[model samples]
Each structure stands twice: as structure tokens, then as C-alpha cells.
Target: MKEHLKHDLEQINHLLDIIKKQGVEYLKLIGARPTSVNHIPLWETQNLPESGYGTEETLKIFNQRFEPIMVGSSGPRYLGFVTGGTTPASVAGDWLTSIYDQNTQSTIGQGDISANIELETIHLILELLGLPDSFLGGFVTGATMSNFTCLGVARQWVGKEQGKDIAKEGISGLIKILTATPHSSSIKSLSLLGLGSNNIVKVKTAEGEREAICIRDLEDQMIKLNGEPFILISSGGTVNTVDFDDFMEIKKLKEQYNFWWHIDAAFGGFAACSETHSHLVKGWEYADSITVDCHKWLNVPYESAVFLIKEQYKILQVETFQNSNAPYLGDPLENFGYLNFLPENSRRLKALPAWFSLMAYGREGYKNIINQNISLANQFGQLLERSNDFKLLAPVRLNTVCFTLKDSEKQDEVGRFLETLNDTGKVFMTPTFYNGHSGIRAAFVNWMTGENDIQLIFETMNEVITQLK
Candidate 1:
């Protein structure tokens, strides 16, 4: 080993001690961290050094070059992109995930307990979401891959309906997919799955500011298929306004239609945590497959999401992802390994942070987080409605506030407004185009967000509007 590597090995405990202290201080000051900063990229970059920098020197170099630009996207005031702040337990677990660094694969026969721990995490999530044991789940990097995994199995099911093994035979026939306002990630998944993004038959959305699927129009689109099998991608919570489809009605349609049902619940599935909002996800448990993001609403670290497919589809899932060529791995059916279940063959113990979080918080803790976030969103929404300078784009449906400038002629100024507001380093939001008007979205999923934070957000907005004029 190099001298630097030798030194690193000798001082591992000292290095970790420094890291632990720094992490604690950072967490302590997380609320004070700037939500935005003026970061100009250096077009010029550096080449690799022949000799390694010691750990201490490297940390200093990183701090000088990159640490100042670090935005508090995980902080309470960060209202962009439905981001969630990590809890104490989750941060602790995340640190240990790197410390252990186990290759999580199998459960029983593989001689590793990591996969079993992952399985248990899935069970906990299912119970928290009021779902059933009939669903089998595993962790993926994020919602994009989670959608890819669930849709991969859905693709296999479609092929099986036509009496062909898609994983073996390849795409020889067209697959029908019907959806209204499907998330962009799902469309990306279709392209990745060899199903053309153009192949999706657009179903009409429900009336009046809702991104939910129109049940009657959905049935009409299904009628065009003439009893042929298709896939129905429904929304649990829309990205813009957090509108949810009528899952109960869709459950009824599933009984009559031959289509596979998939819900991209993502952050919205946490609705089950609130008695008032849980009805939004009613009948979601009956979905053939579901995608829930842990990083967004579960307040875990990044690169964590779970894809749940009904247990009955285990055969198709295995056929789609089975490692058939590797003989030493043994029969895929006999072993029941995770490697043959999802998109990635190799994975970390990604479930540990989520497991730690669930175990620490339990159902009641998450319930409080969900309900509190929803309430704070409403508080912010009312402020926007009362403000003379802003307009409410949609009702504060769940934990997101979709709005725009009140004056329609100021549409072009919206982008600059958001830029200036974010530059304040007090709060952050994302831009959107909704109902033919440019809009801004402020999503609240962070556990630390409170009524005072909502008031701070409005005050910041008011100042920005006044300065812009």
C-alpha cells in the first residue's frame, strides 16, 4: 500500500472521530445553513495527482473547492422538489451503511443477514402504508429506478398475457399503456424498457386543476383495446398540486379490465400516515405494482426507494430479472435471491437507513410528520391566497403549494422572481408551467418545517415581490 494508505489505515479511528464531531456540528447548525448560494462553475478543472493527498489534506481541499456551494436542500426552508430532511436515526444509519459496506443480495441461503434486514424494512413500510403482505418489495436507488423495476415486471406481465416470454423472446409485439399526467420518470422508464415513449395512449385527466385520471375516459380508452391487456399508470400524488387519482374507482376497474395497475406514489404514498389524507391512497394496496420513495417523505438519505409488486407476479419478476447465465449462482427459482429480483444485480444495504428510521420513529412518529407537513403547507397556501401580489394556482391539496404571480402580465418575470428569492438564501422553490401559466411549487416534506418556517417563507416572498417592483 502507498504511504498515504498506510497512514489512513493507522489513523482510522482518529479520522472517524473528526468526522463524527464535524457531522454533529453540521447537524446542529443545519437550520442556519443557507438554502442557496451564488455558485459560479469553474470551466477549468484539475488532473489526477500521481501521489495521493492525505485524508486531512483532501478534506481541506474539498472544503475550499466545493463546500461553500453546498445548498441546504435538506433544510426546513428548502421547498424545492419535494425534498425531505434526514432525521437523527437515519443519519446515524447512513453513516453505518458506509462503515459496513456489505454487498446486500440474498436472505436465507446466501449467509447474509443484510438482505433479511432489507426484507423486514419492506414489511415495516407495508404496514405503515396500510398495505398487505401479498406485496413483495426491494430497494432501488431512487424513484426512477423504482419505476423502472415495477414497470419491468409490468412489461413481463403484458408479454405473458400475449403468450410470450418477453425477457426470453424480446419485444416482438406492441404493448399498450394508458395513463393521464404520468410522471416524467415513468415515461423515461418506458423508453428504457424498449416500449416507445410515443406508444402511451393518453387518457383524459379529471376536471378542474386535478392531475388525476378521469375514470370514465379511462374506461373509454380501455374500450378501444377490446379486452386486450394494457397497463394503467395512476398517480398517488401529482408533482405539481399533489392531486391524487380515485384509487377506489380504479380498483373497481381492475376487477373488470385485464390491465395491470401501477401507482407511482413516490412521496405521496405517505398520505397513509394521516387519517384525513389516507383516503387519497385508498385502494392503492390493490395495485398490481407500486413505487414509494423513501428519501422524499420517509426522511431518509438519498438513493432509497422501494418497488412493491404483488406476490402473485413473482414468477414473471424472476423470469424478467433472473441471472440465468450464471451457473454457479444456482437455480434462480430455488435460491430466491434479490439479485434476480430487481434492476441492479449488486446493491448496498440501502435499506438500513430506512430500517433505522422506521424502527426509531414507528408509525405514530411518521404520522405526526405527515400531518404536520400538510398543515404547514395549508398555512403557506392561505398566505399566498391573501397576498395581493400572488395567486394560488391550485388548492393546497396535500403537502405542496402551487402558485404564481397574481398579475398575468408578470408571467415572464416569474423566473427572475424565483431566482432572486432563492438568492436570498432564506428559502428555495422550483419553477413549473401549469394550466398554461408559469408557476412555482413549494413542497413541504421536511420534518423540521413548522408554522414559523411558513411565516418566514411568506415574509421572504413579500420582500422579494416588493424589491422586484
Candidate 2:
């Protein structure tokens, strides 16, 4: 064995101890860490070395080259892009996931029970969201991959309705998809699945600054298809304004239309945990497939989300994603492998962090997190509304506040304001365009965010605005 490899194996416990100390220190000081940095150093890359540096030496090199500029994106004040903070239990599970290094694929014949644990995690997630066990699910990298997986199955199902196996025969003809406002990831997923992203029939949003779909206009668009089957991609919660489509109304339409229903809940699906906000996803269980991100609302680490597709469509999912003609791996249908049901063939035990988080927090814990975040969002929205310098684009319906400068003529200054505000290193928010106006979105998904964070953000925004003015 290589000297460095042998050394690493022998000193694993020491290395782990060092890592744990670093992690604890970072977490403890996360609130004080910068949400954004103005300057980023460009590290010089070295050529491949014939001799390896030991783990300790390599970690030292990484810290020198990279650690300083690593902004606290997972921190409470980092409100950009709907990012989530890691929970202590989730961090523990994520650590074990790397230590175990299990390739989570098969449930029965693989001798590894990671897939069973994954399935149990899915069950816990279902219970947390009040979803039915009829929906079979597995972990993916994030909502983007989850969207890709579910829409891939939707594409195959659409082809079957048209009497063509698109997965096997290749995509042909127009595939109609209807939606009011889908996350950009969903459109990218369509493109990846060979369904043209530009081909979606853009449905009208509900009246008056709402991003939710107009159900009547949606039905009109469906009628224009002349009874042909299509896909209806609805939003459980829109990124801006947290607007949710009427799932109950959509469910009613599902019984009448011959279409595949997909709801991209992503972070917003956690609203099901809040008694007051549960109405947002009233009939989401009726969806053919749903996407939920564990990293966002579940407070797990990155690259974790789940695609829950109805078990009735298992055959279509397998047909869409099957790794056929492999003799050694056994039949895809005979063995319940994740490879035949999602985009990736080999996957990490991504569900462990989620499982650990669910087990640690349980329903009430997550409910508190969800409700608190929602309350914080509202609190932030009220601050924005009360401020003379900012104007809310819409009501804070859930956990994101979409707002812009109060002065309509100063719309061009929005970007500059956001940049300056972020550069303060105290708080961060992302720029957005909504309803034909430039805006900023501060999404509150982090479990650590409290009234103090909101106050700091508000004060920082004011300071930035004053300077910009």
C-alpha cells in the first residue's frame, strides 16, 4: 500500500478527531461568520504529484488555499437561494455515510440494507408531509435531479398514452406540458428529458400579483389540446412570494383530464407540517409525482432530495430508467434496484442524513421549524412593508419574502443595493425579477434563523440602501 494511504488508515481516528473539532468550531461560530465576502482568492493549482501528501498535510494545504474564503452559506444569515443549514444529527449521519461508503442501489439481492433504510426514511418523510404510502420514493441529488427523474417517468408515460415507448424508441413528436410558474430546474429537466423546454404551454397566473396558476385558464389550455394527454407541472410553493397552486382544484381536474400531474414542492412541501399552512398542499397526495428537497426545509446537508412517484406508475418509471441488457446485475424488475427507477445508476446513501434528522427531530420538531421559519418570513415581510425604502412585491405566503425598492424609478438600483448589502458580510439575499419588476428574495429555510438574524438583516439592508441613495 502507498505510504500515505497506510498512514491515513492507521491514523483514521486522529484525522476524524481533527475534522470533528473543525466542524464543531465552525458550527459554533457560524452566526459570526460572514454571509458573503467581497474578495475571493484564486488558488494556484499544482500538477499531479508522484508522491502523496498524508491526510494531515493535505488538510493543512486545503485550509491555507480554500478555507478562509469559504463564506458561511449554510449559516443563519445566508438567506440567498433558499439554502438550508445542516442539523447536528444530519451532520452525524452524513459523516457515517462517507465512512460506510455504501453504494445504495438494490434492496434485496445486494446484501446491503442501505436501500431498506432509504425506504424507511422515505416513509418517515411521507408521514412528516402527511403523504400517503402509495407514493414510492428515493433520494436524488437535489430538486433538479428529482425533477429530472420524475419528469423522465412522466415523458415515458406520455409516450405510452400516445402508443409509443419514447424511452426505448427515442422521443418523437410534440410533448405538451402545462404550467404557470415552474422552478428553472424543472424546465432544465424537460430539456434533459428531450421534451423541449420552450414547448411548455405557459398557463396564466391567478389574478393580482399571485404566481399561482389560474385553474380556469389551465382548463382552457387543456381543452385546446382536444383531449390529448399532457403533463401538468404545478408548484407546491413558488420561489418568489411562496405562492402555491390550488392543489385541491388541480386534484379535481385530475379526475377529468387524461394527464400526468407533477408537483414540485421542493422546500415548500414542509408547509404540510404547519397546521396553518397545511392548506397549501391540500391535495398534493393525488399528484402522480412530487419533488421535495431535504437540504432546504428538512435542514439536512446538501445534494439531497426525493422524487415521490405513485407506485401505480412503477412499471413506467422502470421502463424509463432501466439499465437493460446487463446479465450480471440481474433483471431490473426482478430485483428492486434504485438504478432502474432514477437517473443515476450508482448513488450514495444520501438518505441517511435525512433519516437521522427525521429520527432526531420527529414530526413536532420539524413542525416547529417549519412554523417558525414561516413566522420569521412574515416578520421580515412586515419589516419590508413598514420600511419606506422597500416595497413588497407580494404577500409573504410562506417562507420567502420578495421585495424591491419602494421607488419605482430606482428599479435599476436594486442590483447595486443587493450587492452592497451582501458585501456587508452580515447578511445575504439574491436578486430576482418578478412580475416584470426587479426584486430581491430572502428565503428563510434555515432552522437557526431567529428574530435577531432578521433584525440584523433589516438593519443591514437599511444601511446599504442609505449608502446606495
Candidate 3:
């Protein structure tokens, strides 16, 4: 055995204590940590060592080389990429996930029954989102994988409609995808699924800087399809302005049309937790498949998201992802194995963090998180609109605020302004372009953010703006 490996195995508790202490300290001081750090300089490091440095020495090396560069992306003011912080219970669950290290495949096999925990977690998630039992879900790495798995099933359904087994016989026939303002992840999934990314037929968005699909235009596009079966990729929340499609109207159209309805509700699906904002996703339960990101609004760790596809499509999902050739693995149809249901054949017990978080904080607990984030988002949006230097690109719809400079002629400075502001290290935001104007989006999904954080964000913005002038 390697010297370091044996040492690590024997001193596991000591190593764990050191790690726990480090993590706790970071969390304790996260509010004060810089949201953005100069990452380029941190790239300097030695190549792989000839001999192992042992766990303790290796951890010391890591602390010296990488720990200082670690930014507080999970802190209160990290507004980039619709990020969210981890809950205390979720962190505990994630640690156990590595410790237990179950392969998380089948419920009935001789292997660990961690899959049962995953199943229960799925049920808990459905309850949290007010979804019906009709949807059978599984954990995937993130929204990208979740989207891929869902659309893979949708592809099979599409093939079934045309009387062809695409998985067995290869992709054939045109699988038309109709959508307005679909997320980049879904488009990437189309490319990965062998469906051309450019194959989508774009429907018109709703008027007035809205990224949501115009229901009238959507129906018109469907009418042009002439009763042919197709796939409709609808946005539950657009990344730029956080716009949601008219799910109720889409449900009405489902009555007359023959198509697979997929909703990429990634972060916005948490709206179901808030009574005031739940109307944004009124009819999403009718969707054939929905993608929800746990790391975002659910405040779990990375590589965690769920794809909720209706139970009626189980056969299609199995046909799309089944590992039937492995005779030793048993019949895919008989066992309740996630291997035959989702994308990856072998996966971790990815549901633990979600299960722990959901259990620790019930519906009311999550409700507070969602509603609080939304309220903070509105407050931040108001700060932008009231400022002479910043102007909102859209109304604060959900938990994201999209805005740009108040000076239209300074549009060219948007990127530099954002870069400079991020360099300040107090707060961070992402840049976007909306309605022909460059914009900045300050997403409010972190649980730690409060009224004080909003003031700090605004103050940072003003300082940056003044520097640019």
C-alpha cells in the first residue's frame, strides 16, 4: 500500500476532524470572505509529486496553495449564475454520502438499499413542490444531465409516435422541437441527444421584454405543424430575466396537440413553495417532464438535480436508457432499478443531501427560504430602479434582478463595469443582454442574504459606477 494511503486509512477520524474544523471556520467567516477573487494568479502550482505526501501534509499543501483563493460564492452577495448556499443539514448529508459511498442502483438486489432512501427522497421532493404521484423522479448530476435524461425519454416518445424504436434502430425521422426562450442547457442536451441544436422552430416570445412564449404564437406554430407530433421545450424560468411560459395555456393546448411537453423549471420551480408567486407556474404539473435544480433554490450541494417525468412514460424512459444486454443485472422491467430509468448506469447516492435537507426543513422551512429570497430580490430590484446610475431591464419577476446602466450611451461600458464591480470582492453579479441592451443580473437565492446585503450591493454598484465615470 502507498504510505500516504495507509496513513489516511488509519487516521481517518483525525483527518475528518481537521476537515470539519476547516469547513466550519470557512462557513463562520463566509459573510466576510470576498465573493470574487483574482483566480488567474492562483493557477500557479507544482505538477504531480513522485511520492505521496500523506494526508496531513497533503491537506497542509492544499490549505497553503488553494484555500486562500477560495471565494465566498456561497455567501450572501454572490449573484452570479443563479447560485445558492448550502443548508447546514444538506452539508451533513453530503458528508455522509461520501462516507457511506453506496452505488445507488437497485432497490431489491443484494446491494445496499440506499436506493430506497433515494426513492423516499423523491417522494419528499414531490410533496415539497406540490406535485402529484404521477411523476417518478431520479437524481442526476445537474440540470444539464437532468435535461438530457428527460429529453432522451422525450426522444423515445417521439420515435414511438412515428412507429420507430430510435434507441434500437438509430434516430430517424424529423423530431421537431418547438420552443421560445429555451435555456442553453436544454439546447446543449438536444445536441448531445443527436437532435441538431439548430433544429428548433422558434416561437415568438410574449411582448414587452418578456422571455415567455406568446401562447397565441405558440398555437399558431403548432397549427403550422399540421397535427404532426413534435416536442415542446418550454421555459419555467429564463436565465436572463427569469420569465416563465404560460403553463396554463400550454395545458389547454395539450388537449388538441400531440407533443411531448418538457419544462426546464431549473431554479424557478421553487415558486411552488410561495403562495404569492406560485401562480407563475400554475399549470406546470401537467408537463410530461420537469427539471428542477436542488443546488439552486433547494440549497443543496453541486451535482444534484432531479428530473420529474410522468409515470405514464416509464416504458419509454426504460426503452431509452435500459441496460438490458447485461443478463446478470436481471430484467430491467421487473426490478425498480434507476439504471433502467435515468441517464447514468451507475450513480452515487445523490439523493442523501436533498433527503436530509428536506427532512430537516419541511415544507414550511423551504417556503421561508423561497419567499425570503423573492422578497430580497424585489428589494434589490428596487435599489437598482431608484438609482440614477442603474436601470432595470425588466420588472423583478422572481428571484433575479436584470438591469443595466441608466445612461443608454454608456451601454458599451457594461462589461467593464461588471468586471470592475466584481473585482471589488464585496459582491459579484453576472452580465447579460436583454431587449437589445446590455444588463446585469443579481440573483437572490443565497439563504444568508438579507436587507443589509442589499444595501452593500447597492453601495458597491454606486462606487463602481463612480469609478467608471
lDDT of each: 0.91, 0.91, 0.91
Q: Clashes in model 1: which pairs?
A: none
- Give one clash count per candidate, in the order shown: 0, 0, 0
**How high is each candidate's TM-score?**
0.97, 0.97, 0.97
Residues 70-115, model 1: lDDT tens digits: 8888889999988999999999899899989978988766356578
Q: Compare candidates 1 and 2 on lDDT and give the better one.
A: 2
Instruction: Tell me how many residue pairs clash in candidate 3.
Output: 0
Worst lDDT 10-window in candidate 3: 325-334
For residues 129-182, could you state the per-residue lDDT of candidate 2 as single tens digits?
999999999999999999999999999999999999898789889999999999
Cα shift from native, residue 21, model 1 (Å): 2.0
Segments in model 3 whose C-alpha atoms lie over 4 Å from true places: 42-45, 326-334
Candidate 1 matches the true fold with a TM-score of 0.97
After superposition, the stretches of candidate 2 with alpha carbons farther than 4 Å from their true spots are 326-334
Task: Give the Cα error of residue 252 in candidate 1, in Å.
Answer: 1.1
Indicate which candidate wins on lDDT: 2
